[model samples]
Target chain A: MSHTRYRVMEAGEARRFPPEAMARIEKILTRYPTKQAALLPVLWVAQETWGWISKEAGEEVARVLDLPPSHVDGVLTFYTMYNLRPVGKHLLQVCTSISCHLNGAESLLERCGKRLGIGLEETTADGKFTLVEVECIAGCDRAPSMMVNDQYFEPMDAGKLDALLDRLSREA
Target chain B: MEKVLTARIGKKDSRSIDTYLADGGYTGVKRVLTSGMTPEQVIEEVKKANVRGRGGAGFSAGVKWGFLPKDTKGKPIYLFCNADESEPGTFKDRLLMENDPHQLIEGMILASYAIRCRNAYIYIRGEFYDGARILERAIGEAYAKGYLGEKILGSRFSLDITVHRGAGAYICGEETGLIESIEGKRGQPRIKPPFPAVSGAFAAPTIVNNVETLCCVKHVIDRGAEWFLKIGRNEKNAGPKLFCISGHVNRPGVYEAAMGLPLKDLIFGAEYAQGMKGGKKIKAVIPGGASAPMLTAAEIDDCPLDFDGVAAKGSMLGSAAIVVINEDACIVDVAKNLSKFFSHESCGQCTPCREGTPWLYKVLTRIEAGQGRMEDIDLLARICNQMANGMTICVFADAAIAPPLSSVTKFRAEYEHHVTQKRCLVGARAAELVTV
Candidate 1:
């Protein structure tokens, strides 16, 4: 894993959420047929406010949705879209699932690890980047792929990853 | 040295099964057939190997199969391979079918044998015409070789596998919805607890596995269970997993690694991703897929690249395709775009999902277009709340609500700015130009 010591903000550093945020969450709960229906969105709000969904956040969502925290957590854990922790400035989501692997994604990821000076689950010293091995990213024609900051790049190689890192570092 | 599974793609003799056979194809199946591994033994081996589903869910394949009733009660056990790559930012399965269809066939056969399933189907997406065609032809080839029809590989067990093309609906990618579609019904999900394993296709005991999940059977059989278990870095979700990266990276494609590789390593490692586009800094990321929660740039260090890690972070290792966002991007616009997609794709069977989706889109769209009022933002949140938690069946409804709710909460300033200032505070005029 990356550095164990992530910069935790003091409780005072936590930004005060606009009152409307709570009102909005409440309104969303009413729109659902059942309060539990609002669980995902409630959790989403928690994640957005906290930057990641914590156990407390899950409980908050569960309470709003009239469900248990375990229930909310079960749903959160099943899907790929929820984030449980803080992410880096750059998220290196490498696709090694079947299609991408058949196209040489493993070597590409290995190459990325060597060049970037980080392994999966670890962030760069500057906290600028985090490399996560993903399932698939919907781009197979261009194999050996990775996604950086919501943009899709394909047919990646070690060299390409290196250049990208330099560019990200410089930009940061 | 190239791995055996990926050797056929972009190389000489990739499209033909004969070439695949020449290159050690079907050897795993033959081994399974000759080794006298019974269904129980096969299941045991798979469990021992610690293989999980490669599809977005990451469920244990052996455990899922174990859910089936022991011995058929004069009813055929059906197996359906979900080839619907409907999840946004997930396309690895399409390439596997396009390049090497036989590997899938052999793997499917092996899985069927292991589960004692006599009938199976591959429900492919309609958009993947080429993949469907290739896999259909491969099934034919398998039949010609006596590998798919009665008496597969001269074994007593007979199996029939067919490929069914699907109309373009994201919901069909869901397991029950896929089952419904295979049965020629609208692809709407069914309630659980008569899980497909217990009562599936034709109300018979059935097992549904993703294309990649079945394809992995060969790997498990070739290597012993112990060897397979040791492959993944994540002790729990053992063995290698594939990650398809797309987005504003230098090199975005697919890469395979042991489970639990750190997200940091995945990004910087070889063939992971080449930073952001146009030298822009990463602003946020959707680590799993489009449906996954967004990770702000500051929170990237919460967990490793495993199910537990993502779960702890309040997201999942869902079809772990990281959708990265750059500093130039507007979070509001992303919510709008995703909302529009889900709204457009909802089957309209459930009122909450059907109406809530479009309403959410309208609110997000309005907010993104600088046409939102303070109440509109609240409306978006309320609508999100209404549509979540299996409101519409499957996760699509909840998925529809996640982005907008999260966006409004995390980027309230942006939404408030839109309403208060009547313009995007990010100075993002280009973001508003999107139709959604």
Candidate 2:
């Protein structure tokens, strides 16, 4: 509920994992003894191919791994990292866990909301960034940590996030 | 204390295998293979080393390996290295993995040989994408160096190490839950009787060790057991321990000291955290991770940062994640935040934890938001009791109760203030925080 909203079932099925991902999946299969056990990685490949895990995407993963669609749904909904629908290109995950909270993560979050013109779990008007409060990332040592998509930034404040947002916006 | 685990951490190119070998890494497993050190002999050496699991449970590593059946009925044994360190206020494992991954790899190789496991996996947290990449590179390096794969170091012993990343689920930190997640299911914990050692990871005998525990194993093999024994306060708590200090400490980071390092020394020691930030006075300290009970400032005067030492103070050093709270923090708000974490992470299996966690969160949410009644405080306590003990398959419910239960008991006046006055006790500093 705090992430990608539920949209109506799409008319047609999504495409299968791309050729590159299929190659990656082939290697991932060797690591696991069973096909079903590679479900998480295969689903991750699907998400990487398409920005999100659509119902069709789930079916494709199920078909690939020889699992039922319901099992794929169960796995998808249980983990928070997967995208049920499309998310912004840049996911601004700010930490609001106790350690970050003590280091003024709440104020940083509020600053992000004010600057982005969006509340929690909301993407900006241009859809460049989606801001969400995350749990304690292992960077608690730095406190008030945030991840700009994949890279971890430490001891973030309003100024740093604002500058980063400005730069990210200018690029695209 | 000798810094076996962290010795190569800050060195140049620490994560590379070249640096690792320069510092004599992978020698432990090489010695084990070339010298014909039997699996039983390796286990005996570890037992004599007296190194406890750096994971929360603090079980002796040797005793746990000894639990495997003598005759496995030909079922292939497996080893799972737990790198899913999502425990709030805990990040020590991330350090070892990111900075000097070869140390962990060598440790896993040694552990796999000791347990006669041919295959092993590192179940790292998905949020740690960067850490995972670093480990993947490190594993590749290890394989290229002939330290892993079949006929490792020219001996009959062979091993394969794979790094498996988990999607975001805190429950996966639980060993059984980890087993289930690696099996490609929702991270729900299994009921224990067979245990992971008996039936785990595709119905094979398995041993799940923490990142730090395995790292210690490599050192315990390199250094004799007697040298390992002399590192800590006692035989029960021996080895170099990585303490993750966060929150209001001036120099919050991972510090590796001998086991049983004094609590006050970590927070105020000149070589450690130094002191509280901005000259703030200490209010409460969570000695372990969020799952451990909170201790008042006065109670931590003589606290020792070890499994038993903290347990003696009615708190367990569950991962040695020290979260220091300054006087400006609202106790009710702290409890509310942690309760929300447990609520979000509950796998929703047991009726008690599934329902009780959200109930506790709701009441605390109301209380922290200035809508609580006087009865809500006691209701929080009653709800915690229902979710713990044998009521659930895993200790998650028990852990879910620690934050709220400990806060309400230790800081009842703060809760009372929030309820009656309809505001946080630290209202003066509320302007500095936006209260997300």
Candidate 3:
């Protein structure tokens, strides 16, 4: 039951958003009547920029949206996608819900574990991929779906898995 | 059996506003605004059409819109589109959002006009990254074309649309939970009696409608109510419906057919699923999303695929997410998979849902893994009873109980087999211990 502890980055050491991201953040903020409504999107921008949501990034988001740091952490932890710890370059999320299960999502997951040389929720030694089983990604029509980062790879099998991993390795 | 909502889905540049305009889109809003039709008249048209919410509740959309108070001196009415398509087996809305984003925009604009709201928001699921990008571009197009954001069609009426993305909470699919999420809080449902129409989203008169329901609103205005009424099997269940047939089907995709279409046709018809994969015999069918109870092979024989039709057969067509299980599949494993999903997704706000869901999953997992005694079956039933029928803030608890309760009752023999034999009977060679 031991959990990996993440080093808390202080506010002074937090990476600031680039000029383009800052502008985009402002544009997103204008869409909502209240600055607080932009909390989730702002967190997304931070995660996209920093690879994962660090403690300082959370504080920065809180400061920009004028929310309490504790409030930002609570919201960030409540969601599964916002990774608090740094993950591998590619996050391979496989769907093992009922629809996907009926279509061999279990074996596909096993294949992913075997091929990646990592267990569920475990990252590879080289930090290339992290395999995790997710709930339905709403791709039931194309059962046995998996998401590599933000892109969805559906109706997948052993062959597709090999090709996908190879391509991702090349890109990395 | 004509496709009004998804007709332009697969075409080239289908997501563009220009394509939508060329194919007679935005006419509904134009007709409502320029024709000087009052909001009351628009509501009357929707009421006549009998369009129901497609976000699993199946409540009348017109009746829901009517719940808002007439007095709006200090309060601003808001419309929130429930685009969080996270129901386990549902993916029809993803198609609409990805391919025909403008149809939804038009629908939202028209619905906002009907509700007399200046601002509307599309609360989409975070996992739908591609769909969210598509919707954002579509909203931009809408604003540029003067279809959204102030003085639509050069009239006094003005409306603004915003697309908000949810991080990754399934409970946000619930309307009240969605409101809380948008308000920068945990996605948890609030108590009823002061419904969203009365006080929602920043303490304003808010109205939340499913993406499909609003799209139906657009068609109701464009094609007239009578045409919609004539498309379904009965008056109560009218309009073309999208049946998301997934799982062991040969052709697993979204099939748009008339309401109350026979379940058998959707599963076996060439236009639909075309029959079970590997030519296996149908074992069981989850007629709705994971929330709805499962129907056995014999029981689903003549059942119609509509809210009332499926409800009459002892299951609700919640989201029309049909997951077909073949003979090779084990019911115990299916139950365990769904129970795990509900347990993981439970917001843990209420004691029953937060505690009972994981408990059900634990027990079901034990039974599925062939480590259960006879007393454990009764324990599972008792736990399900504690979670059902208005025991919690939302129906998440009720949904969490559906798989174990219904599957145990109908497929008790399977559960008994897993208990007595200490191993799975069906698909034993293929079955592996699911690690989640």
Best by TM-score: 2
Better of 2 and 3 by TM-score: 2
Candidate 1: where are CA atoms >4 Å away?
A1-172, B1-7, B427-436
Q: Would candidate 1 be rated incorrect, acceptable, medium or high by CAPRI criteria?
A: incorrect
TM-score on 0 to 1 scale for chain A of candidate 3: 0.89
For residues B1-436, what per-residue lDDT tens digits would candidate 3 score against the true structure?
7777789978889999998899888888888888999988888889899997888989999999999899976889999999999999999999999999998888888888888999899999989899999998999998898898778889988988888899888999999999999988878899996899999998899999999999899999898889888988888998989989898889999999999999999999988889988888777889999999988777778898888999998889999999998877778888989998998898878898888988988998898888998888989999999887988988888888988999888777778889999876564332232211
**Model 2 lDDT per residue over B289-359, tens place:** 98999988788898889989999999889989999998888998999899989988899888999999889
For candidate 3, report its TM-score. Answer: 0.96
Error of 3 at B297 (Å): 0.7
| Chain A (candidate 1) TM-score to true chain A | 0.76
lDDT per residue for candidate 1 within B37-90, as digits (tens), equals 788888888777767777778788888988889766888788889998877667
**Model 2, runs deviating above 4 Å:** A1-8, B427-436
Candidate 2 C-alpha lDDT tens digits along A15-57: 6677888899999999888999899888888888888888898
CA shift at A21, candidate 1, in angstroms?
58
| Candidate 3 chain A lowest-lDDT run of ten | A1-10
Report the C-alpha displacement of residue A109, candidate 1, in angstroms: 34
Candidate 1 structure quality by residue, lDDT tens digits, A84-136: 56677887888764335544677888877777789986777887887877654
